[model samples]
Target chain A: MIAELFAGVSTRARVLLVLLAVVMLAAPLVLDRYLVSVLILVCLAAYTGQAWNILLGFAGLLSLGHALYLGLAAYISAGLYVHFGIGPWLGVFPAVAVCVAVAALLGWLAFRFRIEGVYFALLTIAFAEVARIGFDHIGFTGGAGGFFLPVRSEDQGQWWNLRSGPTFFYYLALLLAAGAFLLCAVLRRSRLGHRWLAVREDPEAAQALGIHINRARMSALLLSAGMTGIAGVFQAFYANNLFPSQIFDISRSIDLILAPIIGGVGTLFGPILGAFVLAPLGEVLISITGAIGLNAPGTKALVFGLFLMAIIAGVPTGLWPRLASLLRLRSVGR
Target chain B: MTLSLYLEVLLQGILTGLVYGLMALGLSVIFGVVRVVNFAHGEFAVLAMYAAFVLFTALHVDPILAAIPVAALFFVIGWLLQRFVVQPFIVRPQHDQFILLVGLAIVLVNALLMIFGPDSRHTNLSYSYDSWFIGPIIVDKVRAYAAAAAVVVSAALFAFFRFTLLGTAIRACADNLTGAAVVGLDVKKLYALTFGLGLACAGAAGAIMVALTDVTPMLAPSFTLLAFTIVIVGGLGSMAGALLGGLLIGVVEALASILVEPSMKSMVSFALLVGVLAFRPQGLVGKPA
Candidate 1:
């Protein structure tokens, strides 16, 4: 079946995928620790990008404050670690459950109340801001003071604990990225995915065609929240701290959305390509400004802003899809 | 606490609410005419505050006295933004417009930060700390002045929209864009004017805020959220609704600060936003569709 799947794909696509996979696999080996750390960030961005893609691209839900999930999961996992000594892996289970439960509840409330479009997006933001303020006041999470995960190890090889070094996280994020991509591919071909696209195009028309719009949107939110919970777990372990202000920030959500949007809103490869390009571009801008000895404090943010505006203004459809058309290759997304 | 203390806080809440009302009204008007949320709404406030700050230090003028010029400047800025960056995306999916505003917000906020370093600054005069004691209440003079200014501005705005031809045309566009266009209204120019008027309101609010609170480049995001919450509480595009919503939010926030941690006081507005959105999307003054 895997061979059969490949047989139908064009030679150019197959070759491109092979080349991309090889680069992803080999990147950590050749790069230094600092560069490998950046690669890890790219992978993390890709994983979250795919998770976000399922909601915005597939289901037409434009959640402006997606960092709610990431922050919630991080606090849950990190709080459990800081106070109870529970490992992050163990903490992820409850974190995922919390995210799914909250997502389902929100979806039910929204759909039942007939809240859609910009109203729905505003509700999501309200929820995130509420969570941010709530977390900041809670004593167990240390309030605004912050909760720090213990990094007791001096040596660099604690794989199970997830505190070996940047290298361990580098591979972990790569695996998560690969898993997320494959999962997105599988879901894209599934019945739910098809229903999602139908709903995205026209909710009323899809509803008339016997598709359940509520269930479709609900599942997408749940799945996206679940995947984001996993990334949050990784982030808690990787960063070794959880500050509600930093984690649950509106800007953090913006960063998550930028990947799929800048690369391609509705394409599979768009997010991956966007993640690959945007992270490095941010770093390059920072380095270049530093090398030039400019005292510009917001160089990265300024650049990111310009890049997002340029993408929206220049190619609202996304780069990969446009590039595919230009190259006469098979389109990469559903 | 005594009833007198309660009265004092209540008076303070009403005053603060009036300024918040100004912020909310700006957002309400912009949405009413332009049909898109300006994510950079709060940045306009920050801009006005900075403008006030500069005039006070450079020309030895009262920040309140300088507010008019700032509002005018912001009006022009808003007009240009509508003409270029925002106007193109207005016809696309509303989601695209939201995205456009998000990018615009990032650019505005970061650019401001680059221009004005991240430190918080404040203006102090001999009268800054002085307050009026009316019966049981103690009102800071600057805050009182800001609230009084808010009332005057809201009145002026009410008249502008209710009596002016452009205001009626704006209302027509908000009510039905196609119909307004059919009626020969210049919807495009009206949109620019409406956007300018909205930013001008924010500028007025920002200048008032400079007298009462410290100025910071980061002030806009929170104010934007505050304005959004007030707008949600009041109802979309309803000027009267913005006034009532802003006052209500202000009172609730003040009461929350007294009852809970001041740091947690912001949650009151957000919680109200969610509650209002879930149960009453039409808002306090909004008629049910």
Candidate 2:
């Protein structure tokens, strides 16, 4: 499917893609442990960004509470692993299923009531806030004290337990990101994708044309939530700690969408490019701040905010589209 | 809870809620006139709170007395923001505008974080520890002062919109944008003015609120959400509704904290918001779209 999708790509672009793949595959081998960890974050962000792009970029549904799904998946999967002795690989299925169900319920409530635009966004935030508060009060998941996943020295090389070294996690994250990218490419060309575009561009017109607006939006939400849940599982094992206040924060949700928004929403490669640009840039800024003897805690966030504004004001289409156009590459999956 | 306790909590809620109403009134005004939801509404309020805090800590100025200068300063800030940051995007899609304001919100919040650090700060007014007893109920002196100041500011705002020519012009713009333009109203300038007025309300509310609670950069987003809940419950674009919604939310939160748990107060507020959204999206007093 990926080959078929890439068949029409220009020779230059194909070469670029292959080169990029080789570089990513070879990254952990040469880079330091810290840089490899950063790459893993970039890949994880790319995966989540692609997941979010499906709803916001493709279907025009602005959800400001996507962290709800991520946090839920993290808690559920980690809880299962911690208590039931189930591995993340097995626990992931239930996590994704729960997320999808939640998305279905949320989507039904929203579409049934004809909540659109900012109201819909606010509804998402409200749901996330409710979940955050609920989670904070629930002692089973450690509440505000935070949930932890026990780490054993003997599980160093266990891929099944997802307790391997940073290199293993990096590869795992890369696979997830690459898989998500290909999935998005294929989905963007599918009938549902076309419907999403149609609905996003003009919902009234799409409805007139016999499109199932609610169904399309619901499917997008389900898919996005499910995909994001997988990332959550990865995060559970990677971070080894989950706090309701931090995981379910609105700021976390904002972080998920920033890559897609900055990379060029609705584009297949935008999330990947955006993740690559943002994660490293953020690391660089953090290091710079540390080196300058600055004790400020929010300088990174401040820079990100300024960057978001600059992107919105100057390149509303985002960086990927402009860069692609500059290289004279044919618009892919448009 | 006992009846007197409930009444006391209700009175306290009403007092705090009045300030909340004033805060949301700014949001309602901007949304009504400029047709833009100030996503940074809470950040502006937090900035005002910081302003008042700085004044009080530095010059020993009372927060109540500091409200005026803070409001005036925020008015100019809001006006400039509308002109420079928001004006260009007025014709863009709603999503773009939302992102723009979200970005602005992020900037303002982190700026506060950088300036004030993460610790929560509050005014140490001399009368902060004092309380007033009226019959069977007790009122904190700070709460009474803040609530009284809120009432005064809200009344002045209402009078401005009612009696002043510029206020009428702004109202006319909100009523009919094209018509106001056709009638020789400088729509752009009016929008900036309305934004300024809205932020002024937020500033005053923030300044007054410093005496009631602590201020921190992290409080900004919650404040924004709280203001949003109030405005929505009261009905978007409705001035009176903002105040009404604030009072309702404040009372509900107080009741929940007392009846249930303090942590569950937000849960109840969100539940209320969801109920209102599900049943009455137009809000209690707002006209149906």
Candidate 3:
């Protein structure tokens, strides 16, 4: 199946793919630290957005609370690290376990009772809020004051447990994102992928065809949560800080979902393209405005809001698909 | 704890719940007709609160009295928002509409943040902290007034819906837009009006909240969430259901605070929301989906 899939790739697509790989591989070495950091952010956003895509884009579950998984991973790992002298390297294990467990629990409750559509979205939001509020009040996790890891500037040269310079973080994010993209790509070709698409398109019809709707939703949710948990671990160490409000915020959830929604839903490359387009642009907008001493309170948010509004109003189907059709590219998506 | 303490908490919770009903009324009415969740509901409320604050500090009007202008102003704003922004994409997919609303919410919030900065502003009315003592149960004057005003408004709105021709037209649109249009009722106009009416509810609630809490752009999501909880629990398209749900949520919140830490209050409120969705997705009063 993998060979056939690759064999189906057009020559032009392969050339572009090769060129893309070369650029990505050499980017860290050639680019400035700031650009490298931005690239890392773009990759991280792509990874997180891909995770969300499995649910909302592929399996048709619009979870507005995906930050719950991120929060779970960050808070659990951060809490364990701070309280027990463990590193996030070791912390990812427990975080993944708990994150998957919570995802399963939420998925079961939502899917088992067939609470779906916008209600499912609402349920996810409620759960995410529950996690945020719970974490904010726990004094052992530093409550609302914030929990920080002791990463000194001189720790840049180290690489044993993800302690390194900005370049190292960039590579790690790139690898993680590439791995996630591959996993999702493989999953999209597997039998499970076909079932997921069926369920997403029409649940009743899928059920009539003997697809277990609950199981399908659960697996997508669990897969999505596991991926999100990994991203959380990466972020926990990368940012070296874990504030409950920062991690579990609704806006944080929005940031993750926005990439896929804006790029294109149900497509493999949409999230990556979206991350590349949005994350750097957003950070750049903020920095550019700040450098000018504009001191505007929500310049970044204003840009994002306008961008999102324009996208929704103009290209509700999202950019990737529209661009794909306009460029006459092989429809490279599920 | 003691009987009197429980009574006080219960009464306070009920009053606060009524205010929640008022806040969610606009959301409920909008959902009933438009079938889109107005994510900007909370921001609209916050803006109304700011307007009320301006009225109190700049014009010497009472906060309660400021509710009238706030409501009026929000009605127009809501109408324009629905017509220009929301109407364009109302025919799109539900997810797309959600995105639109969420984007609008971001725009509204950041716009406020840019204009007002991050500081929360509140009116310092002469009776801000004044309370009425009634035999071991002390009631906040602001709370009582807010509750009374909310009840009167809700009651009047309820009667209007029940008897008025325009009100019935709106309900008909909610119940069956295509049929309403077939019957020659202006469905689009009714939609704008319903959305306006809903925003008016949010504005009135905002004015009442000026005496209860500070106005901040950051408070938007919580207000939206609170309204969601009330509207969902009450069931969409049911105003009385919203009031009952709001009261129930208020009592639960109060009890949770008394039983646990105040910080744990949201933990209880959201848990209750999850429980309700799990058990009754259509809500206590909503027709089954």
Candidate 4:
């Protein structure tokens, strides 16, 4: 299946992909632990960005509250593990299920009311804010005080429990990123993907052409939410702590969308390339700020803001398309 | 609980909501004229609050007095932002514009955080504890002043749009952009002026809010959300609706905090926003799109 997916790729692109895969597979062995962890973050961001790209880039449903799914999934999986002794391997199922259900409800409310464009985005934000405040008050998920996962020293290498070190997480994240990439590639070429493109380009036109606009949008939301839920499970186990304020903040939602946007929205490699550029750049910015004795907590975000503006103003299509064109490579999964 | 307590809360909500309406007024004006949402509307307000705080701390200037300079300063900043940053992307996709404004918000917020630290700051006014008693009701002096100032500013804004030629031109552009352009109206200058006026309102609102609440970089996002909620509930682009929505939200939140809990205030407002969006997408006073 993987080989078939890659069959349409040109020779140069195929070679680049093969080399990239090999390097990623062997990265943990050569890179320092800190760098490996950064790679894990890149992978996690890529996974989430890809998920977000489906809804926004493909289906033209701009959601400013994607953290709703990510936070809910994290809390659900963490709660299951903390209370019921359910491993993340099992917890992920329920997490994704709940997120999909939420996406269904949100999509229904939005589409039913004919709330299009910016209003739809605002509605998403409202839902996320409601969830954040509701979680802050709810005692079950530790409320504003935060939720924590116990790190059993004995379960050091337990993959099922997600109680492993950086290497394990790095590999898991890489696998997820790669899987999402393939999934996105396949979906982009599928009938549903075409329907999404049609709806995104012109909703009324698509509807007139006999496409189920609501169903297409709903599918995008559900698929995106479900994928993002897995990333949330990864976040819970990797961080071992959850705070409603941090996880469910609009910033988190913004963070998820940035990579896809900066890399090139609606492209297969955009999220991955964006994550690769952004996560490490963020780490480097932190180090530079530390070295320069600028102990300001807002420096990274400030730079990110400037960077986003530059990208939008300079190359609105994002870096991926620019880089691809500069490199003279035929765009894949367009 | 008691009727008098409810009345007090109602009054408080109305007073606070008036200021909230003022904060949202800029957003409504900008959207009405330029067809662009200033996502950094709250950050601009926060910046004004910091300016007012600085004026108070450094020169011992009263925030009420400092509001004029702050509003004037913010008007220039808004005009510059619209000309240099926002103007280029005015014709871009809505998503692109959203990203551009969101980026500006992040930059403004983080810059404030770096400069001021994360600590909450407030003016140490002599009349901070002053209040007025009317029969069985107690009105906080600061809130009354802030509300009065808001009313004055809003009245001025209304009069400008109603009576001034430039305001009429801006309204004409809002009414028909192509028609305004065909008639030789410098649409771009008018847009920048509209944006400037909008941020000026935010600046004034922020200056007044310093007396009621602590100023912090963290408050930016919530303020933005609150402005959005107000505009949506009041009906986007409707000046009267913005004020009314602000009062309605302020009252609801005040009553919610007293009746339920303080943290649930945002939840109630969001619920109101969602309810309004679901039932009346055009808002209470806004004409149907």
Best by lDDT: 4
User: Mind sharing the TM-score for model 3?
Assistant: 0.96
- Candidate 2's docking class is medium
Candidates 2 and 4 compared by DockQ, better number: 4
Model 1 C-alpha lDDT per residue in residues B1-289, reported as the tens digit of each score: 4777777777788889999899889999999788898877887788888889888888877877676888889889989989888888887888888887888788878887878778988888669989988876788887788899989988998998899887788889998999999989988899999899999999988888788888887777788888989998999889999999999998988888887767777798888887887788889899996
> B179-286, model 3: which lDDT tens digit per residue?
999999987788888888899999998898888888888899889988998888888778878888888888888888898988788788888788887788778998
- Candidate 2: residue pairs that collide: none
**List of chain A TM-scores, every candidate:** 0.95, 0.97, 0.95, 0.97
User: Clash pairs of candidate 4?
Assistant: none
If the candidates were sorted by their lDDT against the true structure, best first, what order would they fall in? 4, 2, 1, 3
Two-chain DockQ for model 4: 0.80
In candidate 2, position A60 carries an lDDT of 95
Off by over 4 Å in 1: A1-8, A154-156, A293-297, A332-334
Interface C-alpha root-mean-square deviation, candidates in order: 1.5, 1.1, 1.3, 0.9
Candidate 3 C-alpha error for residue B67, in Å: 1.2
Best-fitting candidate, scored by DockQ: 4
The CAPRI category of model 4 is: high
DockQ of each: 0.66, 0.75, 0.71, 0.80
Per-residue lDDT, model 1, residue B12, is 80
What lDDT does candidate 3 reach at residue B33? 83
Give the alpha carbon lDDT tens digit for every residue of A1-334 in model 2.
6678977789888888899999999998899999999999899999999999999899999888999999999999999998998999999999999999988888877888778888888888998998899999989889999999988898788889899899999999999999999888898888999999999999999999999999999999999999999999999999999999999999999999999999988888889888999999989888998899664348888899899999989988889988887777876423
